[model samples]
Target: MALRLEIFDLQLFIHIVEVSSLTQGASRSAISPAAASTRIKNMESTVGARLLNRTPQGVTLTSAGRSLLSHARQVIQQMDHLAFDMCDFRGGLRGQVKVLAHTTSLTEFLPQALSGFLAAHQDVEIELQEALSDDVIRAVSSNEVDIGVVSTPVTTGALWARPFGRNRLVVVLPSQSEFVQLPSITFADTLTAPYVGLSAESALNRFMARVATQLGGEYRPRVQVSTFEAMCRMVEANVGIGIAPISSVERYVKSMNIRYIGLADSWAIREHILVTQHLEALPVLVRNLAQHLADYAQTHLPGPVELSYGNP
Candidate 1:
């Protein structure tokens, strides 16, 4: 008959090798030291070899024990992987997904994708919030949100992140504006121009304001509207020009008499990232949604991205 192995025995042995103390390993395994000794003895008897030498200070592994230590570690590691890997095969889906996204992602891409996700996942509830990039990252890091969509990729310690999409900033102008005649307009040149802005509470508005101030200019909005479409409307009315992501204003480009000018600024280019804690830790429904979002990004956007930040 083949000797049956107990996982706890292997774990106890590995921990003993790690700490050099049978008592400490037994404590970690939640077994009494006497019971641990019996288990080790039984394990040794089954293997037909003495495994360790008990000492006054601590325990030292015998040559046989040293030989088996590497195998024990491999077995424990594989068991841990198995516990997590079995979850991958389960097809269970149901949970709430609290999502926080920055302004560009909230306004441009996530709506359609989220709608599709909602349609597919009837049992899953989604609570979405609009926040700035930094705030979204913080929320995910702090476990306040299940997922975050950010316009710019940043260091997310202990979090898994993937590229979601792009949000290239563009200038919305009336057809007759002289600046619109140019292929692209500089931020400094547009700072002096009449601007239709979003609410002051909006991150994009704050970003533009900060940029203008940094360039030794002020953002004087002719009118402040809540939505990108409203900003485009105000621009179409020749009230003021607006700065928005091309994705946000694409629908209005053909129907509305407006010009989409690229912003000649490095910051104009923005990459969107989906960030969250470990995907395996999330509920089945949430994990599925995350995978769908990643898949969508791969197919629709540039490509798939998997970032495993090794350090916390």
Candidate 2:
């Protein structure tokens, strides 16, 4: 009888090769190192050839192993895609969509969009995780998540990305503060004021830093918070002013005693983006969700927001 090679065995072998260590590969696959080694040994026996050579530095793929790596990866990717397609058939739009979003999108924009999506497609489910913009991209690129919504431009590489919408970065101040009367504020106006800064690693923070640099002054934020909500809380308590996406402020407008002011001469716009792995064939459900988001943005999001950013 011909030897039957299991998908699990091929996946284990490929993980071992890519990680260059049975231990690391096992960790990634959530299996014990011994179990991973046994799987590889079984695979070699089935194939009638030694697949890897273990050395002091680490494991190196043998000629046969090197030859099989590409085919193994292709098989694994196809299997995953197949699973997604099968789920789509069974659940329709109700299947799970694992999304990684930035703080602003999670707190401000996605709630309404998700509500509308779920109302229309009662079967679709969404799982959300919040992270910095850069990490959101990484999650989607590695296929750890299905989609990412972030407030930064997506660059070319291993993922396909498009602009989902545009938001402005507005300055938030105490509603009763003396600065409330100003028609517009400049970066220089914020220099001497005690300000709350968003996390330095966030996309919004980088934009604020650039604005300060352009004004030939330093941004001396008295407090730094990780989320837009926290920044608003601080500003409400009279800790300091803050800058965040306008959408975030709108969500908290009624409850929070804060006012949002647009900055004059500041071209700081937050571009919400959707990112996914570059695939020759995308699952029907995933493609449908992407188009839904694009259509929603066109009707709801204000202004002439470009589709892919470059198309602008």
Candidate 3:
């Protein structure tokens, strides 16, 4: 007779791989190290293979462990949804939606849209995090996040994606700056000048850094700040010119002494998209959040793009 895999074992495996330490993972899962070791051994026995390679430093996933991680995560997510649904049947709509988004979407688009969704679904919670467009897509594909918003073009291989909105990257300069006379400028041209930049960890900064590298240049800022608003303020003080999404620049141009121009690069026009693994397969709470994002885009986005929820 074949032995069966258990949910507890799968969860423990995930915790262990994530922390790279069996002891720490067991502590997080509220189990003793001895019991955790027993469960792991049982799991290996059931599969007829070793999952982890333990060392003096920490544990590393074997090839089988790497393959199992994706499946384990999907199973765990489904089980969690099942538990949440049972609670919902006993009371009201209750569950959390995990979301990953690029910096522009998080800064300009999601706040109002998410606020509206949360207001309507009082019991639903959201866990939002900032990631680059590529990272956002990876998280959605891996089931690490329920929803993802990105500005890059996505191929429909294993994930479903729909356009939600559009934003343009613009160059902001001090009013007295020499470059202010140009109608539009390439992003690479700005790389040669002193720059006011967002923090190094920001998704936008990372994206720009990659672009600069492709153009055989570096994006070293004269000074770095936390927010787009602060970057514009630095430009206003003639600290340095900056580049940011038009949605963010529009809010500050009226009050700040900064001039913004379109970026000549075709990549400057960003088409925002929402990505998910399978809309129909996801929990109702997750589907509702996707619908709310679509509705928000239809109503608020500037362009004449018509988007419907059924595409998901």
Candidate 4:
């Protein structure tokens, strides 16, 4: 009789090979190192071959281990596909979509788009998190997240993508401030008047700092907050001015006692995109949601939004 390998055993082997650490691989699956070693030994004995060579540096995959690695990946992929198909058959539309998006997209356009999608597909659940443009690309490429909404002109690296929306940067100033009357403001001029900024870690804030550096100045914001709403509120209190997305602060201008002015700089305008591993390979529910977002953005997002596909 042929030796039968359990799914867990195969998974353990794959993890060990990928991490190059037996202890780490075991820990990942919540198995003891001793038990994992025993299982690997049994598997080797059953196969009548050495799968890995132990050394001081760590284990190296033998020829047999390399062969099994490819097979393991394919089998896992197929199993995932099977699971997705099974869930679809059991229900018309129900699955979880993990999504990562940049700060601007999260604060601005994605809420409405996702809300519409949720309304249409009541059974599906969305797990959304904020990430920078680069991290978003990396997450989607590694299959760590189901979908990603990222800033445009970024390299997506073999992932299928389409234009999701556009974001325009605006200066948020107190209603009674002198800058409120300016038609458009430049970065240098805005900084001179004192600024209330987002957290230092935010991509937009980093870009703003870079702009200041180019102008031979430093960004020393009077205050820095985590969210756009918070920044707007601070500006309204006359704490200082702020740079925020128009979509984020559009509804808050009158209520929050803040006025927004468009930035004259080119970086003020940004294009965001929807990215996935492959459109055709996506589960039905996930695909539908992605399509819905794309459609919503097409009709709702304002001008100068580039809704095109590009290679990473």
Candidate 5:
């Protein structure tokens, strides 16, 4: 007998394996326990293998089940992407690309880059979200977003990453502050003074918090503000020294009475990268948007002059 499978069955199997309880999985799939059990039995019979090991505790995937789960996820992802593409034919929109990035890219870089891309591709739309670097990587790995822009080095296990831009952290302080005269300063030294901080939830603030913890200290901000510009203004009033990206710092330094100094820590200098599951496997429109972002970064962003970036 030839093996045959249904998409609904595959999706049901995924749901069941994820939760480890057939009843709960059936509830999630909107099918009754009895019907779900029958479907699973049918699937097992067709595949000629036992898929699950069930007990009163719950269920665990057998070796055959693990194999099916992997293929099922891939199939689901492909179907989702296919549906997204087919929608363009039914609707007026040509395509939509989902992108995730950190705060610096969202605020300082992507606004201008996306504006140009949007202007050129009038029929295409982009959905953008701000997240921390780890969250960005997870989203890209799970196929939750079409692309991700992240700072810091990433563990390239299964995902593809290409250098997107170069940026670094800088200390923004009042021009007359005594610390401004120093040639260079570590991140720990900046924490000695009361500092203006970005919103507690922002990616940069969280990153700084982690760095502080690593150095056996704490990040205690004098007052928390929302934007880099706002933080700069707070620094101008001598509220406290603030840390921000060089791109944003340069934009405000001439007008504000604040000066920025580069952080001495090696981690302060970041190589932002574009992340995806598979570059060549992306849809034509998504691949184009990714290329446009890389090209825009090369021309408009600053990076190490000696090294080349982006995919070869």
Candidate 6:
């Protein structure tokens, strides 16, 4: 009879080899050191060979163990893939899709998109994470997430980016603020207002700086905030005027007493993109989701918005 192998046992063995200490491996596997030792012994008994060499410093894999380690890892990975594939087959559109997006997309775009998607296909479960635009691209490139929605340009050579929509950089002010009545204002006028800027590290911040310079205004902001939502809140509280993507403003519009005005400058357009790594064989659900997003983009973002790739 073939020996019954446990997935946990295989995971424990791999962890032991990687960590080079039974204590460390046990800690990682959430198993007691004694239990870990017994499991290794059982594995050796079944295989009929010693798998590790113990020294004062640490444990090293034996020749036999070294030979088996690679195969063991491959087997574990294949098993994981098999489980996902089985779930996909059984659930059909109900299978989970992991997605990563920036805060703006998460707050503004995904809520509507996911609602429509779920309404159409009740079986699909989406696992969405909000991250920075750069982090979103990295997640998609590594296949950690099935899709990434970001404001920044795509950088991964192995991934494909499709233009999803354009977001306008609108100047947000308190409802009672004097700037609310401005027909159209230049970037200089915006900079002159008490500005609550997004983080200096953000792509929006860089774009704002470039536009400010073009309009011959110094890009010195009075308050620096970490998130677009926070910036809008600050603006609503009369802390200072803020410039952010219109989508972000739309997200907090109901709760905040702020008015968003479009900048007259042409440089205020920010394009949003959807990115995915090239799949050898695309999954049916993923293909359907991609098509749905493409159709939505075409329908909503009717006019051309300026697009920049891999820019600060």
Give Cα-based local distance difference scores for all models: 0.79, 0.73, 0.85, 0.80, 0.83, 0.73
The lDDT of model 4 is 0.80
Q: After superposition, how far is residue 88 of candidate 3 from its true place, in Å?
A: 3.8
Task: Give the per-residue lDDT of model 2 (tens digit) for 57-136.
Answer: 88998898986776677677667667768876675654667788876677666777667777888777778877767788
Tell me the TM-score of model 1: 0.65
Highest TM-score scorer? 3
lDDT of 1 at 142: 59
The alpha-carbon lDDT assigned to residue 278 of candidate 3 equals 73
lDDT (10s digit) by residue, model 5, range 1-312: 657899999999999998999999999999999999999999999899999998999999999999888888878777767765676577643577889999888887788888988987688888998888999998787676788999886674688777778887778878878777775689988778998998988888888888899999999798999999899999999999998888788789888888777688898778888878776787666777788888888888767623111111
TM-score versus the correct structure, for each prediction: 0.65, 0.66, 0.93, 0.73, 0.74, 0.59
Q: Model 3, poorest ten-residue lDDT window? A: 303-312
Better by lDDT, candidate 5 or 4: 5
Model 5, residue 302: distance off in Å is 2.0
Candidate 3 Cα outliers beyond 4 Å, as residue runs = 1-3, 304-312
Tens digits of per-residue lDDT for model 6 on 230-276?
Answer: 99889878998887776667678778888866777665665678877
**Candidate 5 runs further than 4 Å off:** 1-74, 87-93, 305-312
Candidate 1 deviant stretches above 4 angstroms = 1-92, 302-312
lDDT of 3: 0.85
112 Cα displacement, candidate 4 (Å): 1.9
Question: Best candidate per lDDT, number?
Answer: 3
Better of 3 and 6 by TM-score: 3
Question: How many steric clashes between backbone atoms does each model show?
Answer: 0, 3, 0, 2, 0, 2
Q: Would you give me the overall lDDT of model 6?
A: 0.73
TM-score of 6: 0.59
TM match of model 4 to true structure: 0.73
Question: lDDT by residue for model 4 over 1-312, one digit each (tens)?
Answer: 787777788889989988998999999879999999999999898878999899888899999988777776656655655666678888677767789998888878788888977887677788888877888998777666778998865888798888877778888888888866777878877767888998887877876787789999988788999988899899989999898887777778757777877788776788888888777887676677778888888898666732111111
Candidate 4 Cα errors over 4 Å, as ranges: 1-28, 33-78, 176-178, 200-203, 206-220, 305-312
